[model samples]
Target: MSKIQHFAFLLVEEFSHLAFSCAVEPLRIANLVSGRTLYDWSFGSENGATATCSNGSVTLVHYGFDAIPKCQQLFALSGIHMRNHVSKPLLAALRRERARGTRIGALCSGAWVLAEAGFLKGMQAAIHWEYHDSFMEGFPEVNLVRSVFVADEKHMTASGGTATADLMLHLIERDHGYDLAVAVADQMVYNAVRNATAEQKVSLQSRNGMRNRHLARAIQMMHDHVSDPISPALIAEDIGISTRQLERLFGKYLNTSPKKYSMEMRLERARNLLIQTESSVTDVALSCGFDSPGHFSRVYKAAFNVTPMLQRGRID
Candidate 1:
């Protein structure tokens, strides 16, 4: 039998409980299915013997940042407000682990911590899609993809949630054999496992529960041009359909007009920027294709029932 591989996870404050379970359970299942000690795992935190997740569940850890032990691989796991939790001690511990030649990875917003430590610069990485806008604005040096996971880089990353399970299954296959990985996945009743190339977001077509190619193309166009929204006529023309037909498609499938749908898309992006990034309101307005901050504020209030400034203030 191959020698056992050891893994350690440094759980950040308010980490995702779902991602935590997904990351560790596959390893446990792999050992059970193979009837061998294929892998072992431990947890560490910045302080104390327990770390709390975003859902208020507390987990016991084997070490703190001050006492991280040697392990074959170390992954940083985090969730919302991850930026606030990237402490000096955490960076120092990661740097020390790197100096010791340990393999490193991240899950969810944990990429923010590694990027802040200057390890993800000039490397291709993945983070949860909710953080895409803020992460790009913060770490332009890092080539961030929308993939569910990235395992080819020196530092691996999973885009949080069940994507961590996909990454774990991939690693199991890589370290042992494909048969064992399949068995582990079967044991978990996870049949729809995605590869690393799979994107983090479900397609608009899937989410809308429709199969109209033209509508899908139009929705994709709106998403791609959130910062410079085009008219519905232009989108219809680009998608090789008449404006009337485009309206009909939207009315039939989404029960909304094309123009209104596009506006909602831009507004949603604006809300994400308002909460996730430190960009000014005017900047956020302009970035989401609004010509004036006053108009943006009025429209935002209509849609979300709060002004941009007040929304941001509430979060702060």
Candidate 2:
């Protein structure tokens, strides 16, 4: 029998419950399927206080930052507004764990905390797609990729949600064997498992159920040109579809016009940059391809109900 490997998780305030459950459940299933104590885990918190999840659920911890127990691996689990939980003491604790040669990783937005601690500098990592722009802008040195998870990197990163389960399964496969990973996955009844290389974004086909080649091509073009947005007419012409047909496709599937979709995409990136990076509002506006800052602000306010200026102070 292989030795029991202990894993510890440090939960931040407002951690995503789904990510946390996904991270731990795989190990539990691995043990159940293997019929052995192949894995063990415990939770930790910054303080001795209970950690609250994003969904308002509370988790009790076996340890605190003051005394992070020795373990084979440790993961930092966080979610939205991850920066608010980052602090010098937390970074120092992670450093101590690393100094002791403990393998460390993150689930979901926890990579943000890892990057903030300088642990993931110069390494490839996966963060949830929503934060990709902000993470890139904030941590320029960190090689962020659009994937469900990154397992082989020095520090593993799961983009969060079910991706955490995929990462845990990958780790089980690496440590034990493919059979054990598959068994664990089967026990969990988790089909449709995705590997690290899978793109994090939902494909247009899967999201909209629109298999129209023209629509796919048009959407791809929009994604490719967010920073230098092109006109809907140009997109329609290039994709060999009439502008009217293009609008109908979007309206039928996405319930929005092409112009609205494109604008929403750009605004989403702009919001991410505003909250995740130090870029000025004008720079963010330009990067998102808004010619006029006033126009960008109006659109942004209308979409988010908050002005870019107000969002600027949100970066941690």
RMSD of 2: 16.5
| RMSD after CA superposition, every candidate | 16.9, 16.5
Per-residue lDDT value at 147 in model 2: 66
List the lowest-lDDT window of 10 residues for candidate 2: 201-210
Q: Pick the candidate with the highest TM-score.
A: 1
lDDT of 2 at 14: 92
Candidate 1 Cα deviation (angstroms), residue 172: 0.3
Model 1 Cα lDDT, one tens digit per residue, 72-156:
9999999999998999999999999999999999998888889999999999898887776678778889888767888999999
Q: What C-alpha lDDT, on a 0 to 100 scale, does residue 201 get in candidate 2?
A: 60
- Report the Cα lDDT for residue 221, model 1: 91
For each candidate, give its TM-score against the true structure: 0.68, 0.67
Relative to the true structure, how large is the alpha-carbon lDDT of every model? 0.86, 0.84
What tens-digit string does per-residue lDDT give for candidate 2 at 1-316?
3989999999999999999999999898888888889999999888866899999999999878878888999999999889889977778889999999999999999999999889888898998876765787798898887668988888999999999988998889889987888788888887656656555667566643346788788889998999899998999999887999988887654445789778877877787788678999999999999988999999888865578998654211
| Candidate 2 residue-wise lDDT at 230 | 92
